[model samples]
Target: MNLRLSGRIRVSVFGVAILIAAACGGDRKTFAPPPEIFSEVDADAGTCADRCSLDGRSVIRCSGEIEPCPIELACGGGSCRQPCDAVATEGSTNGCEFYFQPPLLTTHNDWPYSCYATYLVNTSTVPVDVGIEFEGKALDLSKAIYRTLPGEAKLAPHVGAVMPGDGVILFVSDRESPIDNPRYVACPKGVVPAVLRDYYPDGTQLGSSFHLKTSAPVSAAAVYPFGGAASAIPSATLLLPVASWSKENILVNAWEAWRTYSPGVQIVASEDDTDVTIYPKADVHDGVGVVGTPAGVPATYRLQKGQFLQLVQPQELTGSAIISTKPTSTFAAHTCANVPANVSTCDILGAQIPAFERWGSEYVGVGYRPRTGDEHEPMPYRILAARDGTRLDYDPEVPRGAPLTLNAGEVAAFGAGVGEPFVVRSQDAEHPIYLAAYMTGSNGDYWGSGRSWQTKGDPEFVNVVPAEQYLTNASFYADPTYAETSLVIIRAKTDGEFKDVSLECLGGPVTAFRPIGTRGAYEYARVDLSVGSEPGVTSDGKTCYYGAHHLRSDGLFAATIWGWGRWTSYAYASGMSLRSLVSTPLLPK
Candidate 1:
C-alpha cells in the first residue's frame, strides 16, 4: 500500500471569521517559526534522518525536516495549513504519525479560537490531545477518534502506519478578545464513559457521555436548532399547558374502575337526575366505548359523581396525563372556557387549547383516542389560550422567528428540523418557560454505535452534540398566532425514534403547564428570550458530550425526551465539540 495517498480535502468554515483582511489565497508576511522551536531536517542525503522511519531502503516521511521545502510554516497562528510535497515514500513506524507545519499550539500568542481536522499521519502519532478550560476553571484533556470524514478525508487504517483518519476539532480560549475568542472548549479527560463533556467556571460540566473517535463530517442536509442569530423574544401569552398525571394514579383509577364495573358503569350526579349511558370496559375487538350526552343536556357537561366514561388508553397508562389542551368557545367563539376540573385560571380565553390533531386541515379535540369507539366525545377540557388571531408556520429551511409548532419528536425538535408552533392569542406578554425532549435510543446509551440498529440507521440520531442537547433553564415566546402554524415534520426510518419533545416553565410568576404523552412534533428546537424573566438564560447553558442520532429507515425504534426546569445559570458549559454529531444546513451556500 502506498501509504502516501494523493487527494485534496475540503475544509469547512463554520461561520467564524479568522483574519477579516484576506480571503483564501492573498497573503503578506513571510511566516517565521516561534522562538525556541526548530524544524528537524533530514541530515543524510537520500537517507532516513532525525526520527524518520523507513520501509526497506525507502525513507517513509509523513512529517519531518526538509531544507529545500518551499512554503513558509507559521505555528500557533491558527492559520490555514500550507501543504508541502513528499520527496520520498516516508512511512512512520510510530503508532499514528503526526506533524504540524511549524507552530504547535502554545500559551503565548495563539489565536483564542481555531478549528483543525486531525488526520492519521499529519499531527499526532498517538490519539489527539484535546483540552478545554475556562479562564478560572480547571483544564480537561482527552484522546479523540474520528467517526465521519468531511470533504475527501479517508478512514484511518486499523493497523497501519499511515491511516487517513481525520475529523474537525474546535479550540476556544477563555480570553476576552472580541474577534478571536472561541466560545467553547473540550477537554481530553473522559468522564461518564462514552459521553463528551464540556466544562466551564472551574467545576461546571455540560452534556451526556460520548464514545471515542466517532466524530464525522456533518452533511449539508443536517439541521441545527440553534441556527438563528441571538435575538430577544418579547413577551407572549400561553397557548396551552402540557400536564402529567401519575402513571399509577391514572392506571390505578382506570383499572380499579374497569374491575369494579367489568362490563358497564353507572352515571349519577349530585345535580343531574338523568342517567347518562356508560360503557363498562374496553372491547377486545373494537376498543373502549364512550357514552354520549342525552338530549337537552348542557354543552358543558361536568364529570358526575362516580359516573366515569370509559376511555381506551396506552397500555403503559399507569395513569393518564394531559399532553396538551386548547381553549374552547360556546357559540360565537367569545365564550372562552378554562380547563375542566383543573382550575379556573387565566383572565381571558381566546383559544388556549389548540386543535390537537392537524390531519391536513381536519381537526379534533386535544384528547381524542384514535382507535376507540368513544373517539367522538368532545374533549373533557379546553385550553384557555388568547385569540390574537396570530399564527406562525414552521419550515425546515426557514430561519427562526418563523412560525412553528412544538409537536415533533425529541430528535427533530431538539436536533435539526423546525417544529409546530405554540400560538399565542395575546399580542405580546411574558410567558417564561423551559422545554426538554427525552428519548430512548436503541442503545440505552446515546453514543454507542455498535449497540443496535437504531443507532446506525438514522443520520438524525447523532451521539455527540454541541452543548444544549438537554435544554433546561431557558426562556421563550410563542410565535405569532395570526399566521398559519407551519409544521415541518421530519420522520426518520431509524429504530428507537423520537415522538414528542416537550417544554415547561420551571421558574417565573405564572403557572406552568406540563406535557403528558406524545402528541406533537417539532421539526427543529427553538428558544425565546423576550417571554421569560431571565432574558439572559438560553440554550447556551449546558453542553452534551454524545453525538445526536443518525436518521435511518428500517425498524421499530424510537427515542423520546422529557424536559422541565428553571435556573438563572446551569452547572454545564457551552462551546464544546459537535464532531460526533450530525448536521443539516438551512441554506446551500
Candidate 2:
C-alpha cells in the first residue's frame, strides 16, 4: 500500500485549482463544500437492481478514512458518482452496461431484438453483424459480418443489449430481399443520436461522439406503429475497394457483369464529388450501347433491354479481357422475365426499370417491371404498365400538385401492398410516394383475370385493377391499405435542384425511380446500377431506377430471417446447402 499524503496533503492535491478557503494576508480564498456534506457507503448492485426502481435505493462502499473531499464533497460518494444509478460498479460505473433509447429497433418488448455491437473502439474485433434499417422498413433480417484476426479480441456475434438513446432497425442482408440488398443503407431515423459514440472502421468520428443532433430534421418515420418491432445496438460503415465489382467506376452498370467487368467503378460527380467520369468501354451497353473502341469512336449509344449501367470515369479504358468478353446480354428483360411460366421447375422471374423525369424535365423516360412469384409462392409483382390497349388512370382527387395519367389495361403493381390507392403525385403532404405495377404467374402466383380464392391468395394486387367498369376519374383513387409500399423519388440538384440530396428506394418491389443528380451517400463511393443510369437520365439531374421481385418465402408463415423462407429453411431444414452453405469442405471451388 503506497499511501503517502502529508506535506499538508501535498498542498491539497496540487491546490486543486484553488478552492483554498480563507487565508487573507497572503491572499488565498476559495472554498465550496456545504451542500449538506453527505457521505454514504455500502456496495454491489448489478443488473441495475433488476432494471432500476427500488425506491431510494442505496449502495456506495468506499471504505477506510480518506474524507476531506472539498471537490464538491466527493459528488457525495453515492453509487460513486452515478453510474447511471441503480448502483454503480467501478470506474465509469463499470463501463456502462446498456439502456439506449433513440430509434433503433428489431423486436423491442417482444425480444429477439437486433442492432448488435461488440467493439466500438477495438474490443478485439469480430462481432460486427449490423442491420439497423430505417427509410420505410422491410429489411427483414440479416447476419454475417464477424471477420477479424489482426489483434483478435472477439465476442460480437452482432453484440446486443443496448439502450443509451434508442433508434435502430439496420438489417442490410440476410441473403437477398430488402429488395435484393443493393449495398443497402437507409440509416435515417434519428440519424444516430442516442449517445456513446466512438466509431472508425470506416464510419469515422470517434471518442466522445454518440448520437447528439438537435437541429432537428431526422425522421423518415417509424419508431413504433406502422408495422411495429424495435431493436438497436447495431451500427455499420464499411465500403473498402467495395466488397468487389472489382470496386466501382463504370459510373454505373445496372448490370452487364459489373460494367463489363469493373472498368474501375465509381459514381457521384458533385454534391461533394466521388470524382465521376467513368467511360472506359461501356458508356451504355445493355441500356443502349456504343461498344467498339480499340480506337474506333462512335461513343454514344442508347441501350434498353430492361435497363442497367451507369459508369462515370474520364473514359478511355481498353480491354484485353479482365472482363468484357461480351457474350452475355441476351437481356430478354433480364432473362426472359426470369422464365417460370411453368418452365419445368426451379422457377425464376426478373425484370427491372424505373426512370421518371419532370422536376426540371430533361428527357427522362423509362418504366418496366416483372418480379412475379410462383415456384412455391415467390411473391413480388410490381409490373405497372403492361398495356393491351388505350386505358389510363391516375387522379386521386387531382388537387395536391396534379399530373396523373396511365390506366389503359392497367398493369400497376408496386409490390401489392394491400388496399392500394396512390397512383402518383407528391410534394410531401406528410408522406405520400406511390406508383404501382403487378403481374407474376408461372405459378409464382399473383393471379389476375378470373380472380377469387381469396382473390387468388392476394399478394396484394391493389384490387387487381378492373374496378367494375373504368371511368371513376376525380383524380382516381382505390388503394386503401397494405402497409409497406415504396418508390419515392426526388434527388434533383441541377435540372431543378432539390438541395444537397440522396433519397433512394428498393427495400422491395419499387424498382427504378431515378435522380442521381448526386448529393452524398459518401459521394457514391462504390455505385453499381450495373454502370451509369439504370433507366438513364443524369447529365447532372440524377435519377436511376430498378426494383423487381423479392418474395422471400420460409413457411410456418415466418416474417423475418431474411424473409424468403427463413434462409431457405435455414439451408433446407439445417442440412444446409447453397452448395454446402458457401462450401469449403476441403476447398474445391
Candidate 3:
C-alpha cells in the first residue's frame, strides 16, 4: 500500500488544500505532528486518570475533558446528578446559541422534506434552556457567542429547555411565519408552540431558523434541504462554528444533470472586516493553475463578522479557489442534479468544502446504505486542483472520464461504479486536491431498469476529509429523523499485517468495529452509528459525548456519517480533525 500522500508527478500548480501547520512565510507546507506528540513521554499514570485510548493512534494522554464529564466514581466527582430542566436566563454558564437552516420539519408545506437542525446537550449536569431568538445573528466560536445578528428586525423568542441525556430539535420553515416575517412579530401572543409556553411566557412565533444559547457547550447540525429553491433536494451536513473555520477553500460548482441545475458556493465570514479573494478559472484547465499574473487578478469580496455570501454558477466555476485575509467557512452546492447521468430525476448535492488548511491528500470514496440496480449507476467524483499540474493517480483507475492533469481553478470528474471504492493521490506534497462523491440518479431505467422507478433513490452529496486532517478523537450528534445512519471510515494506511485498525465508537450504541474494505493504500470501515436512535459517548465510558459522539481510532483516519430516511439523505465529516480543535475542545463543559 502507498503510504505517501502524493504520487510521483510533473504537475506544476497548487491544488485545493494542504493540511498545513502555519509556516513561517507565505510558502504553505504539509503536516507534521505537534512537537509534544513526537516527545518520548510515556503514558504517565501520574497525570492520567481513566486509562483512555486515543483511538486509531493519537498522542493525548487523558486527564481533563472539555466535553461533558461524568459524575462517576473514577473521575473523583460525587454524584450531584439532577434533572437538567432549568431555563436559560441571565447568570447561566451554558455557551451561546447559534442557528443554521435544517429541513423545515415544522410545515406540511416543507413535507417530503423533513429539514431540521438537531442539537444535543453534552453537559450532564447543565440543564440549559433552549429557544429561538431572531435578532441579528453572529456566532464566533472562538468567543463562544451565538449572538443575535445586530440590527436585524424582529420576532419574539420561542423557548424550551433540556437536561443531560436529552436531545431536542427546532424546525425551520420559510412559510411567512413569525420567525420568517417580521410583520407577524406582534400579531398574536397565542401563536407560539404550546410546548414552549412554560419556557418563555412572552414568546409567540417560530423563526425560519433560530439562534440557540445554551448555558453549556452543545452539538448541532443542519440537514441542508435535499432539494430547495436554493438547492436541488434537501440534504444534510454538520455546522461548524468560528472555532472550526479555516482560511483556504476548495470551490467547485456541483455537477449538473439538468441544464437548469446551477451549482453554488456559499461562505460565512467568522470575523469582522475579513477580505476574501477568488481565483476563478477563466476556462477549463485540467491539472495546472494560471501562472503568476493570472493568479493575482482574482475577484475580491469582503464580509463583515457573521455575514455570508453565496455564489451560484454553472460548470464554468469548477476549479475556482478562495483565499481569505482571515479564516472563513464555506459550502458548495447545486440546486439539484441527476446522479447516474441518464436518470431523469435530480437530487440536491452539497457539502462543507474543508478549506486548504484543513485538507488531506489521501481519501477513499465510500458511501452509506446500499446502492442497487444497474451497474452503470456510478459514483460521480469531483477533484478540484489546489494548484496547477496536479498529477492524479487513481485506484481501480476511474472506469471513465478521468483527467490526467488539472490547472488551478480547474475541476475534473469521472465515475467510480457503485460499491467500488477508489483512492486518489497527487504527485507533490504541496498540491492536494479536494475529493467529493455523488450518488446516482436512478439509471438503467430504459434497459429493463424501470423508468418510473429509475428516479434516483434520493441522490446525495458528500465530502471526504483528507488524511491530512485525520484524527483520533471525534464527537457529534446524529440526525433524529433518519432511521439509518452509518459512517464511512478511511485510514491513510492499511494494517492487515497488524491487528485490524479499529475506531472505538465509545458513546451512543456504536461498537468497536473493524474495517470491511482494505484496498490500495487505504483501509475502509462501515460503522453503524444508528445515531438517530442512540446517544453518543467519548472514549471514557462515563463521559457522555452526547451531541457529537466521541470517536477514537487505533490509526489516523477520517469518518463521515450518512443519514438515509423516508425522504431525506445527507452526510458530513466528524469534527475531531478540524484545525480549530487543535487549541480548543469541541464541547467545553
Candidate 4:
C-alpha cells in the first residue's frame, strides 16, 4: 500500500486479490486514532508481558480494550508498541522445484573445527531427497523447511541432520589420492551442513563444484574462502535450479596474465541429459564463422541429474558458449585475482552469468564504491554480441575510440573513464549482447603479484544485471570480513517511478541508508558489514543482517552489492566482487 501523497482517500476491501493503492490525503485522517496520553492509573503488566519479544513481527493480539495512540507511534495501543504493516516481499517464481548446487565454492571455514563446504538448504513443502556426489563417491541426505513466521517472507526453519555423525562411514574411501569414479547417493530424509574433509583431506584451497540433486522443491547456496592464511576473501553464489536454466550464453572471460589462478567454466546438468556442446571464442572466425567446431571442447559430452563437468583453461576459452540438450546451470571464473591495474596478491572472481536470452538491451557501467570521488574513476566493461550484426550506441558518449559493429560471438570492451554512466542500446532485440564490468584492482602504491607475499591484484568480475529484469527489491548477503561493501542501484529516472526505498535484515524492516553515488537514475549506497556492525553476527552466532529486502516501488529498478577485501594496516591485500543471488526469475522465453 503506497502511502497516499495527500491524506483523505477512500479505502475498500473487495475480493482477496483486489488491493486499493493509497491516493492523496486531505486535512483529517479517516482511521487514525486519537493522541496517546499517559494514565495515572496502573496498567496490567502481566497481560502484555513478552508480547513484543516473544511473538516478534507477528500480528498484535490485544489482551483488552483498544487504547488511543498518537500518529507519531506507528502502531501502538496506549504506550504498548505494535509493529506497523511492513511492505510485503513477493517476487515472481515459476513454481518449479529443481535447483542447481552452486557452481563455485571457497574454503568452508578456517581450520581445526572448520569444514570443507558451508551450504544453506531451504526446502519446500513435500520434503526433498538430496544426494551429494564427488569423485566416484556419494552421500545421501533428506530434509524439509517447516513454514513459520510472516508468510510473505517465506521463512522456514532448518530441520533434520547429516547422517553418520562424523566423516567416517559414508565417505569410506581412503583419504589419499582422488578416486575419479563419480556417483550420487540418494537420501531418505534429513538436512544439515556437511564437511568434505574426508573427500578432500588436503584441506580446502580452491576446489571442485559438488553436484546436489534434490527430489523436491528447494533453494540452495554454497560459499568458500578465497584468501590464504593471512587474510579472508570469501565468495558465494545462489543456485538458479534446473527450471531456471538457459540454453545459450556468452560473455567476457576471466583470465589472469600473471597466472595466479586460472580461468575456467563449470557446468551442471539439470536433467537426465543428452548431447552437450561448447564453443570457444578463438575457434570462431571474426567471432562468427566456425573454425573446426569448438577446438578445445569435447566432441561428445553428456551429464545426468547431480552430475557436473568442469572445463579448465589448458587453452584460453573465454567468450565461449555452452549449448546443452537439457536445461543446465553455468558459472564463470578467474579462480581468484587482484584489482586497479594496481594491488599485490590475487582476490577471487566468480559469477553465474544468465543466458544470452536474459540479456538486456540497455545498461550503464559503474565502478565499485570508491573511498573518494567515485564518479571520476574509469572502469573497463565488456560487451558480447549475442547474434550477428549488433551495433552499440552510447548516450552522451565518452572517449572509447573503438569500433561499434559486432558479429555473432564477438567481444568488444571499452573504458568508461569518469564519463556519465553509459546508456547503451542495441539496434534490434535479436541483436542483444551480454554486459559485464571489471575493476582494474588497487592503486600503484599497493599493487604486486606472482609471489605469496604480494597483494593478489587480479581483475574482478560482476554481471551488469539486465535493466529490464531489475526488480525494485533485491536480497543479498554481505561478508563480515570484507574491508569495503557497497550497493550499485539503477532505476527509471522519470517521476513516480519508485517509492518507499527501505531495507530489511534478519526478519524485520530497518532504516539503514548510506549513499555512495547518485548517477542520474541510479543511486549507490555503502553498507556497514563489519563483524561488529549492524547485520553482523548476533549473540546466537547466526548472522542477523542476511535476508531478503522489502521494496515497494511504483515502477521498476535494479540493484547489486560490491564487496572488497583489505586489512587495516596491510599493503598486500586486493579485493574481488560478484552480484548477489537475484530472487526474481527471468521471464520465460
Compare the candidates by TM-score and give the number of the best one.
3
Candidate 2 residue-wise lDDT at 556: 8
- Most lDDT-accurate candidate: 3
Compared with the true structure, the alpha-carbon lDDT of candidate 2 equals 0.18
- lDDT per prediction? 0.18, 0.18, 0.46, 0.39
**Which digits, one per residue and each the tens of the lDDT, describe model 3 over residues 420-469?**
66666565545566788765554433223444322324567777666555
Q: What is the lDDT of residue 493 in candidate 2?
A: 24
Model 3 residue runs over 4 Å out of place are: 1-166, 177-217, 226-232, 282-297, 373-377, 396-400, 443-456, 477-484, 491-521, 527-551, 565-568, 580-589
Model 1 segments more than 4 A misplaced: 1-131, 134-147, 151-427, 437-589
TM-score of each: 0.17, 0.19, 0.61, 0.57
Better of 1 and 4 by TM-score: 4
Between candidates 2 and 4, the one scoring higher on TM-score is: 4
Model 1: per-residue Cα lDDT over 1-589, one tens digit each: 0011112223221111111111122111221111111112324457543332111112224355322322322111112122111211121111111111101111122212222122112222123333222222333323223322221112221221212222232222212222423322222222111122221111001111111121111111101001001110001111111110010010111111111111111111211121222111122112223222221121122332212222222121111111101211010011111112122210111111111120011011121111112222221211111111212121222222222221111001221111222211111121111121111121222222233322211111111111112111111111111111111112211123333332222132111212211332212322222222123223334311111112111211112211111100100011011111112111122
Model 3 residue 124 lDDT score:
35
Between prediction 2 and prediction 3, the one with superior TM-score is 3
TM-score, candidate 4, is 0.57
TM-score of 1: 0.17
**By the lDDT metric, which is better: model 1 or model 3?**
3
